[model samples]
Target: MRTLRFLLQKEFRQILRSRSLLISIILGPVIQLTLLPLAANFEVKKIAVAVVDHDHSTYSNKLIAKIYASKYFSGGTYHSSYEAANKMIEQNKADIILEIPQGFERNLVREGHEEVYVAVNAINGTKAGVGSGYLGAIVADFNQDVRLQWNQPGHFSEAPTIDVVNANWYNPFMSYFLFMVPGLIVSLLTGIGAFSASLNIVKEKEIGTIEQINVTPIKKHHFILGKLIPYWVLSMFVFTIGMLVSRFAYGIVPVGNIGLLYGFLSAYLITLLGAGLLISTYSDTQQQAVSLAFFFVLVFNMISGVFTSIDSMPDWGKALSYLSPMSHFAAVMRMVVLKGSTFHDIQPHFIAIIILGIVFNTWAVLNYRKTT
Candidate 1:
């Protein structure tokens, strides 16, 4: 225990002695927590819409008013025909085109029928889908109003009513920023800690200090714990800064218990640091250790569902995703931030990471040697 304490102290002093590295450890989390949330917004608004009012009647004007009144749409301009609207859309001026047929109101009142055309650009399928849904809803609402005015009290025999109640727990708004920011924080910390801690041990090996330590009476576990624990603490500091930025700067409140988050994050830190130690066990140069650690982290990020949904992936891909620490961390983060998940909700991922941490830490100790 005393040897472990001494080694931990030495590692802390070594980390603090490097001014540039300490600054990176402090500021890297800030940049990730701030920029990533601001950049990753999924909700769309102010979709430009063009109107081709062939009728040029009060009814056409009323329909245009309703379209513009909707929060999803913004009025681009009035066009004489579909050709003109198409020209505007071709030039990227409009996302939706509304064409009101000639004699629209007359047909509705006298013939009991009128038709309107809505053309939506489907180049960006997501935007088009959402915009089309909004336009369809507005048109349906207007048709209902017109029918009500025309003495069609129960048009569908029964009052065709649709009731939708959506409940979004944790992040009720489903803020994309809130969901993604924590994951970005995890990615940044993983990259930094893995590279830095691995480089520390590898640098000692390259310079012959590892031999000096080996010659001493320091137990293998004592040396390993001393080197790893300080970085683990440093990772915790980076994580705390990330949490503060989430709360104060980005308004990302974790709906789950803070203690639970911290606990899992601590486990995650050990997993990362242990992986770095394993890299050090294999490599003698700081550059080699950093490069190898980066390769693994990059591969982990790609497979981790950090930027994509894991549920959308194939079974083989999903099976492969569990190999990454980021995958488990991302899953746990979503549950904690979005579902307000308790320990029970995240037990599988938490247990997997714990098992992974133990396995890697064991591999690091077994493979690591005092000599070359």
Candidate 2:
């Protein structure tokens, strides 16, 4: 117990004295939490469009105006020909081109339908798909409006319509910030645990401190616990700061019990610390530790179900993600934040983390030796 306490003191002093680690601990959460959510947005907007209008009719003008008025699209730049308009797409100035053929209004009025060619730059497939879909919806609405104007006091009566009552459950406005903040919190904690803890032992090894410790009467588990505890506590501090940032800056408040969330975090931090320390045990140099830590952290974050839905992934991907502590952490964080899920709801994740914590800590203890 005395030995562990002295070791804890040494670890804390070492962490505080390092300028680089201090800067990372201070700045990492704030910048990532504040900036990343705003930037890593999924909702596509401001689609640049080029227009070629040959008809110059009332309907054509109205359609052009309607497309421009939409929040999804940038105002269209009119070109003399389709060839001229397509050049905008080639130059990356336009994402989609809308060409109104000659006699577009005449054909629609006389034949009850007309086709207009739309050429979208498929270089950015998602932008193309979403931008084209927005244009199609706007055009469909315009057609409906034109038909209604010429209907002469409800001649055909209203067609059967099914309206979906949207129960948005958690995020009513679908703010991307709200969706991203929780996941970002998990990612921030993961980085702190992985990079910071992984560097600890390796740095000591490089500086010849590990040799002195190894020759001491210290137990391996005591050495591991002393290493893990300080960082775990510091990570909790960072997590608290992140949560505060989420509240004030992004307006995210945990719908579930905050204590329950903290309890889960406490256990989760142990698991992450164990993982980092395990990496530290295998690595001889700080460089090797960092590279290994980053590789694992990247893999864990990618499979963490933050950016992609686990259910939507392939069978193999979904199966493999279960091995990552981060996958469960991100899921549980979202559940607590959005769904107000209870302890019972998160029990399975809690158990998974506990199991991982045991495995990682045990491996780290076994791998680390008193002698080189």
Candidate 3:
């Protein structure tokens, strides 16, 4: 216990004495917690619309009003002709173009049907889909309202109609910030653990302190442990801060067992520390360690689905993600944050991490040697 405390205190002191460590530890989490959530959302809004009304009647004007009133669409520009609206769409000024044919109200009143043209930009497929749905919904509602006014018996018919009681489960209303903050936290922790931890040790070796340590009574394992304990503690601290920020900024509450989370996180940090140690062991200079760590971290962050969905990735890319700790961590984090999955629900992932931790730690230790 005494030795452990001494080691912890010494490591803390060493970390504090280094300005770079202090900045990365503090600013890294802050930037991730504050900025990344805003940048990683998929929600569509404020789509520009254009209107072509040849009818010049109250019905055409009302239809245009309906489109503009939709929360999904911004106010539309009035075009005298479809050709004019088409130019606006082609110029990227309009996301959707609507055209009501001439004599639309006359056709609706006499024949009970009128045609409306809707042209959408297919370049952004998802947004175009959403915009099409919005336009369709508005027109459908208007049709129902017209039916009630014109065809209803005293406008109070109680017929069996299919009413959709749409309810969103789990992350209801889909707060994008809540979805992204946790993933950013994982990315930041991996960067700090993989980069900063190795940098300090490699610097020591470059400056000849490692040579003196080799002649001391300390074993290779003990020396590595002593070096890693500080960053392990720092990583845990950063995670706690991230959780607090999640609750306050994103209103994200963890539904999983907190004990299980911390337990797995403990093992996860060991794996990350092993990676840092492995880099330090192989690197003769701090520059090499930093460059190699940066490359690996970038690859891991991209493949891990930090900003994108892993489900969208190809089978081979998804399968290769097993090699990345961030991939596993991001999955578990999102599972806990959104789905409220139990440890039992994540057992396979947990077991995989355990095996990976053992393998990385063993490799790091084997690469580590003491020379007198």
Candidate 4:
């Protein structure tokens, strides 16, 4: 205990003395939590549209008005010819071109059917898909309105309708920030914990201080724990700051027990820090530790379901994602924060993280040589 305490003191002193590290530890989360949510939007809006109205009738103008009124669409450009609209799309000035053909209103009124050609710029697939969907919805709504206006007394007896009241359980408003902030917090915390722990021993090696501690009577476990403890405490502090920023900046408060979230985070950090120590044990210099840590962090972020859904990944990729500590942490965070998941709900992830911590820390211990 006494030896561990002294080592912890030394590590904290070193961390506090480094101005750059201190600033990063304090400012990095604030900046990311504040700025990332604004740009991480998944809901496509303000899609640029081009319209070619050949009919130019009252119905056609009403349809164009409906498209312009939608929040999803930007004010559309009116082109005289389909060729002109194609040119606009080629120039990247428009994402979609809606062409209302001649006799569109006449066919709808007289023949009960008409076709409107829609051409989309598929270069940005997500934008194209979302914009097209929004346009289709508007046209459907306009068709319904036309039917209601044309209905005579007792002619259309309120066509049977099945209203789908879509209930978004976790995020009712579908706020992108609600979905993204927690994942970002988990990812950033993982990187900070892993990078700091990985760099600790290697930094000592670079500065020629490892020889001094190695000659002491301290056990290997004590040295490892001492290295782990300070960063663990610092990471918890950073996590708290991140949570506060999430609350104030994005109105995100964990729907579950705060204690449960902290419990999962504790285990997740242990696994990440152990990986860092493993990197430190293998690396002889700070540069080598950084490169290795960056590599692991990048892989973890890519597979962790932060930017994309794990369910959408291939079977092999899903199986491989379980190997990443960030994957477990990201899942647990979303479950607890958004869904109000309990300990029982997150038991599998908790157990997985604990096993990872044990495996990684054991490997790091075996790799650490007092004499080397």
Could you give candidate 3's per-residue lDDT for residues 1-372 as a string of tens digits? 455566668778888898977887887788777777786668888888898888989877777787777788895798988889999989999999888889998998888888789999999998899988889889988887776767767666556689898777876886777678778888888988888777867887989987877787766667777888888888899888888887887777887776777777888888888888888888989889988899889989989987777899899889878878778888888888778889888888888888888888788878878852
Ranking by TM-score: 4, 2, 3, 1
TM-score, candidate 3, is 0.88
Indicate the residue-level lDDT of 218 in model 2. Answer: 93
- Selected candidate, larger lDDT, 3 vs 4: 4
Please list the Cα RMSD from the true structure of every candidate, rounded to 1 decimal place.
Answer: 3.0, 1.6, 3.0, 1.4
lDDT (tens digit, per residue) of candidate 2 on 29-135: 89888889878887889898999999999889999999989999985799989999988988999999999999999998888799888999999888999999999
Off by over 4 Å in 4: 156-161
Q: Model 4: clashing residue pairs? A: none
Give the true-structure RMSD of model 2: 1.6
lDDT of 4: 0.91
RMSD versus native structure for model 3: 3.0
Relative to the true structure, candidate 2 reaches a TM of 0.96
In terms of lDDT, the poorest run of 10 residues in model 3 is 1-10
Q: lDDT of all the models against the reference?
A: 0.84, 0.90, 0.82, 0.91
- Cα displacement (angstroms), candidate 4, residue 109, comes to 1.6
